[model samples]
Target: MGRWMKPEVYPLFAAVGVAVGVCCMQLVRNISTNPEVRVNKENRIAGILENFDEGEKYAEHGLRKYVRGRRPEIMPSLNKFFSDPE
Candidate 1:
């Protein structure tokens, strides 16, 4: 009754599904079975550590921001940005 895919192609679709499932299972095993990865996973801040540098990086950056001529570009038009007049 369907026009897009033939019934005979169902086996090919099932084979692709099984292949993808096997790849996913292997990926999970690779991550979960690693000693280093396991240690990282057990950490409380692992998720945050993935994207953020350790505190020392920020300490140096903050110390440098007070150099003589550096000005933070504080937003110029705060009222225009927040209020849309009707």
Candidate 2:
């Protein structure tokens, strides 16, 4: 068989894998540290909290629910509130 199509494609595959891994990692980190995104998330949380009384347990309950892989239904309400209807 010709060398170009041979089974020695390991190095080429590894190079492509490494490049894709680096790009994904950088993208995740960049998004995690974005200030505007963070602010919007905090504002959403605040909006959710508005339905509760002062010093209520809703915040803690939300954290627990989110950690348990549950998305609250109130998310749509918050999104609708924040979204521009224009």
Candidate 3:
């Protein structure tokens, strides 16, 4: 009916708690830094190639159209962004 106050039992509880905390921290750290989380450019390109079709555009052009509104066009805005050679 009473809690265990034996001198030896306190250390056992403390040890178990520390071990569990360490294991949890390790799990969190590992999950955050997992190497398999990044996107693979080659795989993305291969997927697009697999679904290749005539008259279809590249992803960059598709993205430009989606953001800027209209059919996909392949003109780079870099010329406008950079200063003229004059």
Model 3, poorest ten-residue lDDT window?
A: 50-59
At residue 15, give the lDDT of candidate 2.
Answer: 97
Candidate 2 lDDT tens digits, 1-86: 47666668878978999999999976775566433333455565754333444334423545576667655555876787778475
Worst 10 residues of 2 by lDDT: 50-59
How far in Å is the alpha carbon of 68 misplaced in model 2?
40
Model 1, stretches more than 4 Å misplaced?
Answer: 36-86
Question: Model 1: per-residue lDDT, tens digit, 21-43?
Answer: 99998678556543334445356
Q: Best TM-score goes to which candidate?
A: 1
Write model 3 residue lDDT over 1-86, tens digit each, in one string: 14687776889989999999999976774455433322567644554333444214333354466677643435546654564554
The TM-score-based order of candidates, best leading, equals 1, 3, 2
Better of 1 and 3 by TM-score: 1
Error of 2 at 78 (Å): 60
Rank all candidate structures by their lDDT, best first, as comma-separated numbers.
1, 2, 3
